[model samples]
Target: MRQGLILVVFAALLPVVAASFLQGQSALEDARKLAFERMIGTASAVAERQRDPFVIGQHLLLVHATNPDVTDMTDTCDAALRASLSSYPPITNIARTAADGTVRCSAIAFAGNINLAQEGWWQRGVSAKGMTITKAPIYGRIAKRDVLFLILPLRSGDGRQNGTLTAAIDVNYLRRALHDAGARNAGTLAIVTRDGKVVTDSNNALAFKPAMGAEPDQPIEARDKDGTMWIYTLHKIYSSDLFVVYAEPRAQLMATAVAQMRAGMLLPLISILLASIAIWVGTNRLALTWLRELQNMSARFAKGDFKGDQARFERAPEEIAAFSADLHIMADVIDRRNTDLTQALEAKSQLTREVHHRVKNNLQIINSLLTLQSGRVREGAAKEVLAQTRARISALALIHRLLYEQDNGYDRGEVAIDNLMAELCLQLRSARRSMFQVELTCHARNFPVPVDYAVPLTLFVVEAVTNAFRHAFPAGTRGAVHLNLDLQAGDAILEISDNGIGYSVTDEAGQMGTELMRGFATQVEGNLSIISSEGAGTQVILKFPLPNMSITNAPPLGSVPAF
Candidate 1:
């Protein structure tokens, strides 16, 4: 009974404890104000130093132009006054005009010349009242920067109004000085008139907003709707309506508000009770004991065993729903690819046998025609024509025989370097009626590739070799035909050299198939170089990069192809 009474007393006292914590908020506000005031104090020190004396002198000069003695619209006194300003120290630019709005004389840097009659600041200075200060304007091509010019009416010994004195103030220097004062350069110091004309800002020292004319009701920091306290303070410059404002955001200013709130925690039971209710309403996963069979169904789908379907995706946790959708999409793609592969194989099989049958029948008919044509012709030209026709027909017949011997057709039109060179020599021997003998030597290793990749490459090699035989070793010259083929850097390399009274390789290579040889190489996306050294026989190296050789792993090249 005593313990229960003690617990009740503690709960009842928690509100009072929280209220005591709120009371310290006033102290936090005091600290914030002190810190902001310190920052403003620091920034003001540097700002004063940036106001150059030359700038201050021009300010007085602009105001002096309003004096009545300035009646000479274009007076020599204006020139004398300007010369005096330029001759004096701390002044970069100066201009003055009479109260009637006429520029009298102008002086700038000792080495500078500026026309005051057409200037905006000159006109404004002439029209300004006693102590009017104009917002800085970006003017003049000389230094072409934004500057605030002060205008003060000149006063004679009797206190009469004379011409005005104008002084140029560069705001860019003032802004940078403020930035150097703080960490973020977030402090803002403004020289405001009775109106809200923000004369100078720490950020855009030279920037003057168009609406900086005047403000009747200005912002003062205090509590917002959230009941947070803010601090805003203003200091009026001595003997002037201009106020310098210093302020900061309340939330940012108060550093100790959070520590005080945490130290004030009195009761944890209420917070715990609220947490339990939130957990019960939000969680409904398997731990809630809602679905057992659905788990088994999703497990099978995840393992890619989608055949035996179990429960639908109705009871899995929200996190697993996206995965379930992906399973359905994959099943559709696999089924479609399988059907396409099967149909394509069947069509390919039927077309292969048909092509073999038609090619064989065409070769047999051509051979019979050549035989009959040779019998009727008696002239040497007629017999040579029939002989050439017979040789072409035999080559076509060889193509058919190879096709029927393989299910893959890889050995049909496609030929490896070793096998291709041997076959070309045998066929050329049969086709040539000359007395000279032709020898074929093939030196190459097993370079595996697809038929599409090998066929065109072999055709290019065949053309290069034949051109050597028919034209290179002419007129019964007993010499050797050399063929060297290799593979390097995903490319098929072949070198065909011939030694047989080889016509100055340079001149002979320049004619006939030498030109056609380039076209044949391009057919296979390969390269052909006729590297023939004078009488040392013609040597041709054909480089063809094989397909599917992993170009991604190819060595970095010094340059790119023309294409």
Candidate 2:
């Protein structure tokens, strides 16, 4: 029942847990979308800002190219160019190169023996109809710094190219502009050429290059050369060859989404845990506690102990209280029944003991009558018969005496075979003539047999021992008799042997004592064997199935010695 309650709680909470998981997933996706939009917007804004300096430099160069002093290379042309360079910090130098590669007007003096005739930018600018910018930055020979040149073609009246007016934009100045733009953003920023060369970056340690086949305004994830993951988007900065890349670390980009997911799930998980704990405690208090008390009471009742406090269940739920009441009533009924059975058993045992006492008295009276009759008999054979009958009667009376004397509660109707045999051997020894000098010894294992089998068993032992005392030894002969009772496997074995003048079984086949022993053996459902040979001891063996009774002080197997 407790398990069922817990399962019910889980069943109710399962939907909440599933909904929480789905809600967390939705929250994470929404956070990702919002983060992507912000990243794209930042990339676009930074791209525009980065393009500003290049646009201003281009316009300045275009205005200066149309100036008469600069176009005619007059004496004031170098002074005008130097004044323009001082006004704009982004421009490193301004110069005019003739079609044949001669430096005519300059803002900064040329370094080395430099000529622009073979330069790729100058060659492309001379034949171009309008201004052109270099695809990548180059080291300026005149300014002695990395720069990108904006070149304007000097044309004749017929539109043929004559010379070029050029202004070098400092790469470091553009890098500074990009850094300022990046300061307001949360991610790194970089400008890269179409060929994947980095022109400037807010952070140089990060290889913030554009991804292959990346579309403008679309975000993509890529790993840098150092294996750091980044989420970045690209934007074109005024030209096809140059692009601005805005990127953030993937972990940083997803941090908000992860936090939102965790928050979304936390409440439901806590709710389930708290609910389960409540159910566990509530069930134990309302039902399980009383059930446990009832279970303990039932166990006590099974052990015949009905003394548990019935008031313990008074505060329980109605059904449990009713159950406890019924259980207590049943225990009372069983207790009363047990008391009645105990009283009846005591009365029956008392009656059985009384009956055995009366039977023992009657047998003792018969033995006494036989003893007195044997004294008056004249014939020796008749007296012998009377004595034997008296001995048999004595054995029966001994059995009855043992039954009447039994005080232990267990198996009062049974006689301890060991005690019976020991006393029987004593009686046999006492009855023998003193001149015979027969040493009688009895060794028996301690197990009880019911009175029905005990009667025949005792009679069998008495008759066998008496025959050995009466006929096995001659007058004035010294001999010994041994009686043994043993249990082997599930069979009881009783053996009586005597060292006396042995008799032939063929001659004693119809003897009264032998016939009586055989009849007694049959009564106890046993097999009897008489082993006798002239000049050898006589042995009588009786094997029977042991009664179903516990044995005490039983000797180990094979303890009986060979005669």
Candidate 3:
């Protein structure tokens, strides 16, 4: 709660701090403007000294083809221009050509003669109207310098083109000029064409760094490292849209703004701290009241008063408002849950009663079928079959009885194999006491098979035992009937063996019982194997896959075929 109060107070004070700092930035801007103005003035002075359009024009106008005292300008006049311009420290080499399409170049300061034609700077000036001017950036081999070749057209007083004169200007001299104009700063400054081509820079560190694309073209307004605001001032040279820059750094000025911000936050922080203390005290009182109410409400619920409200007289501070709302919602939810529980209990009771009634009805139907079949029997063999059928029905009836007695009928209880087998044998022995004796053995404990699977399995066992008795022991012959039931791994294997004469799989001539056994095994999702030799016993093993999913531990009642 105290932490929350502190955060709220801090949020309210943060804006005052931001605005105070912004004020210092405003002052810094004014100072930067003043600083750049002085730098620009200095830059302008250096530019004026280098400006000489007329002097350049006159130097070009002095040459004429008819003035014999001077050399014929037929070819060498252009060479003379280059030589003359090279004499100045600021120039390296120059070239010239008449407007009539002739050109020359030279290696000496004013004497080494060479001739060339159709020069770029000469063409630029001649193609221009009147006494046109042009400047070309070039890298000169002899001068070993980056220089600008300036071409000026010499014209008659009436503006007729006589010829063109050219001069080369040293770039280093321009950098020196910008140096005095306070160009020593972290960021670079350069003179550039309006097209973003760099002509010169104060430091010349990145001699030809590309200055175009997504940066400010004119003066730039931005904040500095210390959040001190300032502006950049730019100047354009008159003739060619060439530009220069002056920057004013302003970090020191923003400290004033930082001071104002600290001052503004002081009052709000103190007030918030005081407010937090008061809220802390109020929340402490309200929390104790809520805890006591919770204790009383839980006690009432323990006494079975589920309808009692959980928390009342609610007085929650903002810090605990969310927790209080969640508690109230929880109580409303619990009240709804109790009502649902009562309805669910009554529904469960009705379902159990319905299941019991259905089971009784089903058992009656099985008994009726058994009674009707027993009444229709005439011959001894027929009566014996009827009695066996009755025993099979009883096995099925017992499964239903077990299901209805258990809590969750479908999933619980196993048929006791020993007891089920004992009863089946007795029923068989009573119907017909042949010389054949039936021996049943089980190795595993009793386990459940779901009613659906166990019903078919029970009937299958009865049919196998009856078949062995009726057919395996012939007249004046004696043999034993061995039936073994086992639960192993994933399947319950039922092996019924008889010392009867065996037959081949292909010889189904009179083997109705064998075929039927195969069908029954398949019906219960199991496999049947018949092993028989003339001298050895015939063993029929039906691997009835017990419900791998379900089992119940219950004591076996005598050895019997369990459902």
Top candidate (TM-score): 2
lDDT of 2: 0.81
If candidate 2 were superposed on the true structure by all CA atoms, what would the RMSD be?
Answer: 4.8
- State how far residue 44 of model 2 sits from its true place (Å): 1.5
lDDT of 1 at 542: 78
Which scores better on TM-score, 1 or 3? Answer: 3
Candidate 1 lDDT, 315-423, residue by residue in tens: 6666444555565566556556656876886577557756766786788788888878888999675695576556556655555544555543432334333443455
Clash count, one per candidate: 30, 0, 14
Using lDDT as the measure, which candidate wins? 2
What candidate 3 gets wrong by more than 4 Å, as runs, is 1-379, 407-436, 443-448, 473-494, 497-510, 544-563
Query: Model 1: runs farther than 4 Å from truth?
Result: 1-333, 356-426, 429-437, 444-459, 471-479, 488-491, 505-511, 525-527, 531-535, 544-563
Candidate 2 structure, TM-score to reference = 0.80
The alpha-carbon lDDT assigned to residue 427 of candidate 3 equals: 53
Q: List the candidate numbers ranked by TM-score, top first.
A: 2, 3, 1
| Clashes by residue pair, model 2 | none
